[model samples]
Target: MDTGLVGDRRWQEKIFTGEWRDGGGGVLPVIEPATGAELGVAGKAAPDDVARSVARADEAQAAWAAAPFSERAGVLRRAAELWTEHSAEVRTWLVREAGSVRRKAMRELGGTVAECWEAAALPSHPLGEVLPSERATLSMTRRTPVGVVGVIAPFNLPLKLAFRSVAPALALGNAVVLKPDPRTPVSGGVALARVFEEAGLPPGVLHVLPGGADVGAALVVQPAVRAVSFTGSSRAGHAVAELCARHSTRVHLELGGNSALIVMPDADLDRAVAAASYGAFYHQGQGCIVVGRHLVHDSVYDTYAQMLAEKAAGLTVGNPAEQDVALGPLIDAHQRDSVDALVTGSVEAGAKPLTGGTYQGLFYRPTVLADTGPGAPAYDAEVFGPVASVTRFSTADEAVELASDSPYGLALSILTADVTAGLEMAAAIPTGLAHINDQTIADDAHAPFGGLGESGNASRFGGPAANIEAYTDTRWITVHSAIPSY
Candidate 1:
């Protein structure tokens, strides 16, 4: 099988109807953020391509859905095996195409492999429950696939998010049309299709269309597409939701976050510093659940801030393929500019930089901001970069109030030795995922992962339970014995 990364022309083909074809949306250049060089060009899918892809997926849904659970599971397991076989190639693409550091690329590839295998188990997951009936009857509920699902993934962590949605949708016997960010299509989008195709996924059960917002909008409004799973900025997520609403389609969004890491007076300073540093700087702080705010208690705030600043300053920012580089370039110059603007605005608004507030090309330094006020952009908005805004609180109520003061309720972390205090603090916070004595960005394949409020639309996208919910619809049935009277 062709890996599809052979040349510029080969990269310009869309995965549609089980084969590659040059899409109508013309050619888009793929840039490597680390060096600001053109990696290659990818084919962009037009609106017509979107319609055709969805139509094909619609046609293929029934037969795929009718296939036995064991068969579907076998395909998914084979896909996982394929991922393992191609891990090195995928990791290289991630590093070059998406600006992911070696460690981050490895982690994402590993997670994608695990997610596929976990999705394979979705077929064996319980569908629904049997309920007692008032009369001499039996009542039970069952789940069915929601038909063709449209997945729109962002460039950051492209491979992981695409499979995070696509794998489960396929596991539940639903066809999928995935639109990956054009910038990282080869790494994020096409590679996925290669895996499934090699694993013998039926034609049209999975399609990859690489393009911009036009393709995504077309997918969202396609009549055959019953559901949408999106992961990206809150602004884009809201737009996707609104478009899906017009079609009366269900959408599961994993949007932006300004998660906070709270440090209590009795917290272990070393552990808190390490967790905060990793949470805020990992993946160049590009993750949605990154710890953007560090709320330290007044008692140890100065010491903690000092240690965090030292750690942030010591991080190596360079080419992603380098061995010792901890931070890589942002996805593009636009994102780097945005991060710079936010940092500059915060500093102008009375926030002081404790460690870093500089950039070279698309690479932004790991920054720690001190004395950030409520009105500062760094404190109020999602920076989506390697910048941690620190503020001090005197009491637990103040900590909770500060932590819960964001429009994004994605995730939060409470670091304290006392489990009781951590639990109490966790209960008070309004975020979706709360961690005691750990960072906010940790995810397990078996747990439900999503957010509340502006972070998402109450849709979970991890584990078998979430897959069952997102990819299937519940139907309740009742049967009366001996035709009992109503």
Candidate 2:
């Protein structure tokens, strides 16, 4: 992957079957944060444009609903195959647009494409069950697709986020209207659209419009859209939730998180250092589930803190296109400043920077800090950059309380050599997903993935139950004998 400007004028000539030109003519410039160089431009969609996409999706959904489930699954499988073929190119695009480092971008591209293939196989086994009847004739239950789904993807891992809704929705025969983040829209829209085209999907089944907040607002409020699946910040998630409330549409939010990670006294100090480094630096800590708050047991606090600081210092922070670079720039300058403010505020509140509290361009130094009370901003805030705040807990109960104390319960990790201690802490934490002996970053597509409480809007985790549930709805069927008519 080479860090360079992305995008060509050809997108103007491109359309996903029936997708129209962006109505507002709002064009967002894609810039390389590191160099301040122009990458290219993407068309932004407004309220009317969102409505247009939704209308088209509604039209397609009717016909798609009638398509064989196997046929829908086959299309998704083929898209996954195409994704694999273009995996290298897609990684390059991600590094340029999403500011992902070469190695990390490759991993993201691979896993996200696999998510689609996994989603495709679901329809081959549409959920169904039977109930034996003694007095009644018969009873059965099955699943049905919802109407059109509105998906709003975030700037980081743009395609991966969009695919979350696109893969499952199409597999269950629902059309989608995707509103990708303005900063990084080209590859997600172009790549996925091409795959759908090659898969021989019909017109209007998949529509994509790119824009800022206004575009997102339009997509969620459309009357024809049955649901919304959003991935972004908490404040933005709230707005989407409110918009959907107007139309009574179901909304699935994978929103903001300030996750907690607890390291016990007996844990492997080196393993702890590596996990913390990856947790904070991977994607520059932009992911909602990354472990941003680290609580170490008092005994090993010094040893672990020293190791973490050294490791963070050793990380390479530069252009994401460089294969050796371990850390990439934050999405933009505004984001870099936001993380800076959080770190500065923490220091003002009486925290010590064990190492790393600097920035160069958009790249934040992998920062580690020793902090004070649990009420500190560093403890609970979503510091979406390569920054981690470390603190000490006296006991297992204290660690659990500190970890669960946050308002956001997106994800968590507990490190300990004692089996009983780790399990107890895991059981006590308030997060949606808790990891033992590992970082919170690892999640299987087949397992449920989501945050709890403020991190998400009423949607459940993604797994066998959740995946089929997301793409379909329960329907009951009953039968009665004519003998009863007598």
Candidate 3:
């Protein structure tokens, strides 16, 4: 199945010019989510390809590190502009390759590009000012960039998360090596590399490398790589943490979550159902911050369940390319099997499915389960599919208690009319981030993103500031040469 010569309009191979490609083998299939059909074959770097990539990265990074922050940041701005210009084509590939819905994909891709542009403008943003002391002239300290960063993203939100990492890393003048998920290795669309190349970055400053765990591990463990930015399941994230920890490597991991959303007694049922449903089903609930536990205050539980079930019923589940599709298939047969098994195990263990537990092709019905034991896989495991485990609590204190009962704490939503109660509950949730008056996940690019406990470690706040902060090591410049102001 030779797709013939690779054309500018289509990509045949994922490029690797850094040490990530040093040990090189060759290409592997990358499937289109819509049909489970092959879209393109991505290069899987061999041990040697990986070595060469590192060598290139190490060789290329010193100059990038030496480049002026202003000049480096300008490249990110140009890339953002190019991303915006190519939104349509990017969305097309996203819809086909990743099974992302057209409208949602468009918005997310656009937002991702916008954030990258904003990252480029950050060096000029104000921090704080201090008047110098005359005796020996003391001045305020600033920031600097790490030499290189390993930027990785999962298949579900590939471009967005990759942008969350690479844009900031570039802005901070850290040369980057990107490892996109092997499942959806469209490399954030064809023009992604072109955008940066046009943005005027020095050759090798930014490189795209896509592969599986072996490739990722090689990059993370490489001495030339200074930091890692990753998003995936808690189990996988733990492995990343351990590997990096063993070598004292720095990391920012967005790991697995079975996040709980507390909709209090005072919250409107209309809003609560919308939040829970959207939070649970968007991206097929593959999101790390998906609302897996729907902990409603007892006063509104029945109505909330009804609205939720009705909403779930209306979400058209099918192949992504179909005109009527609302929710598409999971990423692959493995995810399909996992979702089905989790739902079946929950049912066998005594949970009741409100409306769904159906599976077809890669599609798992938007499932709603209630009354499962706290320890059952449905409630206990990170259900990376469209399933919700409903639990009721009588008070705000009870809500927090139940929500925090699980060891995972990535992100949680607190929906309530009482602003005071919302803030109070938000403060008590124990998770890294909490949302109020909102059902779905909402992360500002400027705020830190990561988790604690089983949810993983390394807080990655995406944006120019977080970009510089995460990648750079700060050391005070103590000018000891000052002829003592005696």
Candidate 4:
């Protein structure tokens, strides 16, 4: 069957144990949000397929773990090289399948390459520590790979997010069974398999199963799957964590976030506005760490709100493939409608719409809401779209309180010229990441990236140091040079 789709044909196959196969779960149509068109169809993995994938990963884990670190690192380096070499193709896939604007697509591709290279270097870095023993013996701790890992990646930034966990898991000598979001199976899942295979990765060391929630559930509960790394919404994260808990499997979750950006009176208006614009609307505010709340000091509240309104109105929204388009369409109609409902509910609750609160089809206007009080859904709930809700505060304490009021503590930004105030605010907020004089959405390959509370499960990802803790198990050993007389 043609599957009634358009775009790349390579995406039609499922990557099973090692080779492409027709999925037993049937076909899933990939829709492009930009024009509401069918981008392609992907072979979906069934529950049995997921189980087979886990078995293959478990079988491969032993040999891969026993392989020398240098050998494994070499393959990762090759994969990184291939990712960079095929950057153009990867970018196209992201734009068409993920509804990523040109710049966002480029950023994701670049980040994927960087993450792979970073993971490749993990073998050369210190993975363990030497400890002083109470007895006359040398004591040290060694980090060893966990067996098989189930990686459930999200649709937004699918390739980058998947690589965030997959590369590190592979670098640490763990076999991974990845289940990418069905909507982005080709760009997110299949492309990654191709990269690893071309880079000489051992067959069965990595498996890509493109499917929906059922496949993810199956992967999470398999006896051989010792750990799981998932990135998605809080509701889904909770479910996955609960499932893993039942099986006594370790799971790392990077879930939903309702971060805030606080603008103090001492902050430069231009810088604050720029920070708010980038933090709140970049990638159309679909990021987990995107600033959902904008808290402004009453002294500068009017000016900041006006400036932000103008900025939101000025942003261009159109086809994601267009170079100049600043905002792209939502992933699908469901998400678009959800965003609309949140905005509508907030407006009805007395939150004033400052600018751009409407939408046509999947492309929602960059929206800004002022006077959004505590009772309004937009004030506390995560919109997960191109929307920013502003609330004015009377004092520094009030600004901090408002920003820290949310149940989520993912990423927070405080814009102020006063270093002391910035430091004070950072100390007060309980988010995983905090920025002063910068946007909240920035991430580095060498930094610990994850969240707190509902945003994450207190587990860290990214960087060699953090991944060493996440993907490996620690064992303490002591050796005696001479026999002790008792």
Candidate 5:
């Protein structure tokens, strides 16, 4: 479905104050990455737009915070209903504008609904606790909204990434000013605003501004925005953190990952291969938690490599919207070139390309590289592509060392027949998330989702406790029937 041909007027405009309008920056053409065809145009916001959005959200937050908890929960519940009711339209936007495959788009759509439902529960949760005090008084603590929150979302998995923060912020009685990447404004920005708008979100409560780095910078520095939830590259994450730090604003960052998938000698070969293929090639490996390293025990390294290579070669690659292919194009040519450069560099550094090391247009084939070692680009860096670099490890210690070598500590997975051994290995690794007998690309809407080191600020973004902490400030209060001496 070309957005140009769609009849919905909202998709082509910027959403602010519960209404649609042209942006201050002019229009941005939405292009289909797979075919480089113009899907349509979306309003492009300028830096000035960010200021207006933050100012509006700040003014609207007080009334929203004072509304009944039931009203807040009802808004989120209605958003969930709208999400499911308009699933087909959202799926098309994801596939066409965000370059996601059919199944991946469906998964994102379902996850968005789950996020909304999980957020709805936030309004009714116990927000504070009674505390012991030194004086003769009842002391307690309660959470309060942080005024306006700024959400800066990325292109890949845009809908889920944006809403995971947006839904909770709104449910917690705070307004939000969202900045979706210009490359994927519709799926990440317009789609979300539409659902909330139709669900009866009030004016100035949620602003969807589609723009680039300039707009993001403006949003982060706005005095009215007390916090910012950012998801993007580690380089950009660092930049946002620095700006927020200077402004004394809280920041929650979900950045890059070079996750590892360790296969033990005693692992089931078929199951291990299946998990590896899925983790490495899901959404063309555009995800942060997708497998970046394949650490195989020396005893079964040859067998595992052969199996994975065969699986990679057999996957069909085509336009996701038109074909039921296992792999689709990268978001654009720049991403494709970056991925190819890493593969080429790794191969030149003596890594063997077991299946693929080439591409045509944006569709990079699922690649398997054997003998991947230190100093190789694909082995050491977060390539963020459908390239799996396999390295041989003789012992459990070696596997742990190899997986923990990178600066990133986002996610890890171990495939083994011995559950105890897998668990032990997982404990030794420093990642925030780990799986035994499973793959690395795992996320639950109700689970704490984040990472350590460069992957994020350790300020996670899901579940009741984390979301409450992310979107609100806890305050302590004391009650006394009589005046107490100082």
Candidate 6:
């Protein structure tokens, strides 16, 4: 097997259709975010490529869907094994192309394998239920595939995010057309094509296209695409939803989040501090479920903020390819500038910068802000960086109001020794996921995962239940032994 690294002879033409070929569009340079260097280039997909890919997928889907369940399950099971076998090469792509630290890269690799394993089980799950029928007939309902599925994934956590949708859609007998972000095409797109190709997925069942919004828009509106799965910013999600709606197509969205982590007066102080640190700084806070607000009870607000500040200051930030560090560089200068502007604006608007509020190049230091009042930039929006904003709440109602104030409601975490009280307060806030005595950043391959309100339209992915709902349509079937007099 070719390693597909920078110097690999096979890398120049990385697009896969059972064999490598130069894609429809020209070429796109893949850059290393940590250091300003071109790692390699990936083939880009043009408009004609989008049309041809979808046509081929439609042709392959019928035969693939007709295959035995055991055969379909076997493909995904093999993919899980292949992912682990190539972890070393995959990690290099992650660290250099996607700017992930070694630990974060390993975490993604492991999670991706778990996703494949979970998807492998989908083929054997019960399709539907038997329902009662009127007068002299036996009635039943069974799930059927929605034909071709279109997926658009972001740069952050590329492999895990893309495969979470791709694997299940394929397992349920639906073909997929995936559009990974152009910036991190190697890890996000080409590598996935090779993994599936090696796993013996039939040709044209999966199409990996690396391009920008133009390619994504084409996929969403394509007449042959019956459903679409999108994961990105809330703004982009809205655009995709509108396009799908115009075409009468089904869409599953996992969008942006400004989640909250609340600490009660009686909470374990050390535990609360640790949760906040990990929740806000893990992956440099680039996740949709990363904690955007820290609501601390007035009794413990001062002490908790002080402890968090100390922890932030102690964290190391540098290029992950160079040293062992807690945080790595942002995806690029645009991301770094956005994070810096939010912190700077909040500080000028009366929020106190307790620790780090600056950056040098792409590496922004872990920052903690105190007194982040309402309407402050970091307080009200999703700051996708290593920044934690702490606010004081006097009572339980005050805490609930503060947590529920954002337009985004992806996740919420409440911490207190009184479990009953924490659960009660968490119930008041409308969020897709609520955690007691835990942080906001969490995922399971066997659980329904998504958001609510502006975060998403309540469409979820993961687990057998959600996968069936997302990729299949239920149809009624009635059996009559003989026709009676009308």
Instruction: Return the top candidate by lDDT.
Output: 5
Count of residue pairs whose backbone atoms collide, per candidate: 0, 3, 18, 0, 0, 0
Between candidates 2 and 4, name the one with more favorable lDDT.
Answer: 4
Per-model TM against the reference: 0.96, 0.94, 0.92, 0.96, 0.98, 0.97
Off by over 4 Å in 5: 1-6, 13-15
Predict model 4's lDDT versus the native. 0.87
Off by over 4 Å in 6: 1-14
Report the lDDT tens digits of candidate 1 across residue range 1-486: 234333334445444557877798887787888887886676778999999888888999999999998999999999999889878878888998899999889999999998998999998888888998777778999899999999999998999989899999999999999999988988888788778877999988998898889989999999889999999999999999999999999999999999999999988899889989999998999999999999999999899989999999999999977665999999888888999999999999999899999998888999999988589999999999999999999999999999989999999999988999889988988888999999987777778889888899764787777889899999999977687555
Task: Return the clash pairs for model 1, or none.
Answer: none
Worst 10 residues of 3 by lDDT: 1-10
**Candidate 3 TM-score over all chains jointly:** 0.92
| Residue 6 CA displacement from its true place in model 3, Å | 9.9
Tens-place lDDT digits, model 4, residues 1-486: 122111335556545568778787998787887876776677889999988878888888899988988999999999988888777788887888888888899989888888998999987777778998888899999988899989999988999999999999999899999999988887788888878888988999999998889999999999999889999999999999999999999999999999889898889999789889988998888899898999998999989999999999999998877656989888888988889899999999999899998998888999999999688887778889999999999988988888888889899898988988898988998988999888888777778888899999764687777898889999998889988898
List the global CA lDDT of all models: 0.88, 0.78, 0.75, 0.87, 0.90, 0.90
Error of 6 at 380 (Å): 0.8
Stretches of candidate 1 off by over 4 Å are 1-11, 480-486
Ranking by lDDT: 5, 6, 1, 4, 2, 3
Please state every model's RMSD to the true fold in angstroms: 1.9, 2.5, 3.1, 2.6, 1.5, 1.5
lDDT of 5 by residue, 1-486 (tens): 533313466556554555787789898898999999987788989988888878888988999999999999999999899888778888988998888999999999999999999999999999999998888899999999989999999999999999999999999999999998889988898888878877888888999999889999999999999999999999999999999999999999999999999999999999999999999999999999999999999999999999999999999999998999998889999999999999999989999999987789998999999999789999898898999999999999999999988899899999999999999999999988999999998788998888999899774777998999999999999999899777
lDDT of 2 by residue, 186-257 (tens): 666766776687787788899877777877887777778887888889888989989888889888888888
Clashes of 2: 3
TM-score order of candidates, top first: 5, 6, 1, 4, 2, 3
lDDT of 3 by residue, 1-486 (tens): 222111242345546463122215467676876686776766665555555666777778778767776877777777777777676667767777778776658767876876786787765655334546554655555556677788778888778878888777767667788877878766452335556766777877777766778888887898888898878877788888788898788998888888888888888888788878888988888888888998887788887877788889889887666664768778888988898899999898888889889977787789888776486688888888999988778877888888888888888888887888788887887787778888647666666677778876646665555566687776554344466755
Better of 1 and 3 by lDDT: 1
